[model samples]
Target: MIRKANLQLLIDREYGIGKHGAKAEFARRLGKQADYISRCLYPAEKKGGKNVGEDFAREIEREFSLPVYAMDQQRLGSDTAKTIDVEGLPAPLAQKIAGYRQVVEVPRYDVAGSMGPGTEPPEMNMVVENMSLDANWVRNNLTYTKIDNLKLISGRGDSMAPTIRSGDAVLVDSGINTVEDDAIYFFLMRGKLQIKRIQRGLDGLTIISDNGQYPPIEVPGEREEDITVLAQIIYWWTGRSF
Candidate 1:
């Protein structure tokens, strides 16, 4: 039998039960009842109820981007002792599963760029630090192919309130320097780095703030190069607030 501790570790590491209502969020993603998932994580000792079964284990492997064999070992125990080859699976799926086993380090800049009203953007000195993120999370969340080009920077200002709050850390894909319609981007405007939603117009590009308090800014289509696009904001997380 698979030890309960191993299963609990997987839940705590991946689902993060107490953090951000992760248990409920994971349940919703897995399309399973929350109570049932809770039971699977903490099975009853007296009644000897069924633990997480192979069906649910496979579902978790597929949905959560985990190795099926690892979960199988923890759920089915000796039955899954023999090494299973992943070569039989489709090439793309196999490659993704293989990538999940690795970790990637992303560079985090020292400066915090404004998202709302602010002065000129500060210069990016050397990278202040590096953060190790799961390769699976990076590949699944970001559309960019070159993972090395990804950078992390902090956003300052309430102009983008409600959606992206002040002091939030955003992941910027430096490879995507082009402005896509209605897409949020981190760019340099008048030497100041700012993040805003861009909308292409007949005459120019419209820069918008999520907060209604701030009015939009317009740039002539011919002078688009003046506004140097640094990167497109892919993902962001609350900094100190969390």
Candidate 2:
């Protein structure tokens, strides 16, 4: 028996069932009726009272290159349902699945990078603490491929307000130090680390803040070295402030 949620996730990921006409296409590829396949996949549903047989389950595993046994082992009320253990799976699949279950620790510094009116930046000290994020979430959301190069920094000031409030924790990819048009970046200017949206033009680069109160600053394109792009902002976490 397979848990309906896990079965659905596997089918959606492996067979592209969420797309239009994919269910029919999947059934066609398996040489089975779509209705029968649906019933087997959703045995608890009123219209789907049939459980998937071992032969059909093996057939699905062979045809789709899926870990059917691993999914079936996730059935509710099973002895091993307490934890998600992929030890029984093949090496490659086990490794891939295990990666999702793993967590990545990103270093969080105490220093706050000004986002509004500029201020003298503090020397970033040793990592104050580590923030743990899901490996899969980090891989999916970040532009950079390397996980170790990620760092967490706090935002200061109200220049980037509304979008990035003060005290927000931002995930920065230090590996990405180039200016991407209209994208937010953390960089050093006049010895101070700042977060701003950088837009490139033929004349120069325009550094902007979301709050209209702050005027944009222009820097010559040829003098790119004047500002050392520390990292690119990937994700942000903030709480409501009164």
Candidate 3:
């Protein structure tokens, strides 16, 4: 059977906004409606999500010129992108290792975010030194569709304590603007950029600080106008003395 996660990752890597992948173009190429394609990709029960039938799956393979039954395989996206040795690793893990040769520069920017690797101008010199990351690894290991949708923002204070210390830089996924689930997020609050772990509960939402010294703040429902979820922190990096 064709795995839904496999197909979704394929779409993300091959047809997401990053890496020159556009859903509208993909839809046009398949001779299908963009909305229909989105429903197939996103597949939410509350929304108009649907599964791709066997016939449609075969059609997709044919359209993409993939081998017969390729979609039925795990990590279908990983196998097709510039073949390389996986060293017998699992499909999910193998894909990440296969792209060590493919690296991209991820520049540092404000939490508000005005730049990324793909859009860096040579004269600007905004790109951070030694900030290059494996392209395919970023696409596979990180968020599926966030190949170029990242920017480095410096974390401040010890609100997140042992998890994210003061002055450490976090790789923020600029593509996510909503709180789809509970996770650490870099956001704007009352006109200032802030990072915190956000959780949704039955009564309301709680903005938490990993450091217990700082108390959590509760926001009833969502304050879209005052608070903006600028991006989600996918990865972080720091170097220090012993």
188, model 2: CA deviation in Å? 0.4
Q: What is the C-alpha lDDT profile of model 2 across 128-222, one tens digit per residue?
A: 99975545555554577478888999999999988898988988888987886578999998778899899999888999999999999989878
The local lDDT score (0 to 100) that residue 121 gets in candidate 3 is 19
TM-score quality measure for candidate 1: 0.62
Model 2 scores a TM of 0.58
Error of 3 at 222 (Å): 5.6
Models sorted by TM-score, best on top? 1, 2, 3
Candidate 3 positional error at 231, Å? 0.2
Superposed on all Cα atoms, the candidates' RMSDs to the truth, in angstroms, are: 8.4, 11.0, 17.8
- Comparison by lDDT, 2 against 3, better one: 2
Compute each candidate's TM-score over C-alphas. Answer: 0.62, 0.58, 0.50
Task: For candidate 1, list the clashing residue pairs, or say none.
Answer: 121-192
**Per-residue alpha-carbon lDDT of candidate 1 for residues 1-242, written as tens digits (9 for 90 to 100):** 35344455455456432245666766778887766666666546645344877676677767756666566564324224454467989998888666543446789988676876654765545798997665555665567748888898888899888778887888888888887757888988877888888888889899999989999989988889888888888778764431
Off by over 4 Å in 1: 1-20, 23-101, 239-242
Ten-residue region with minimum lDDT total, candidate 2: 74-83
CA error at residue 25 for candidate 2, angstroms: 32
Cα lDDT listed for each candidate? 0.72, 0.73, 0.67
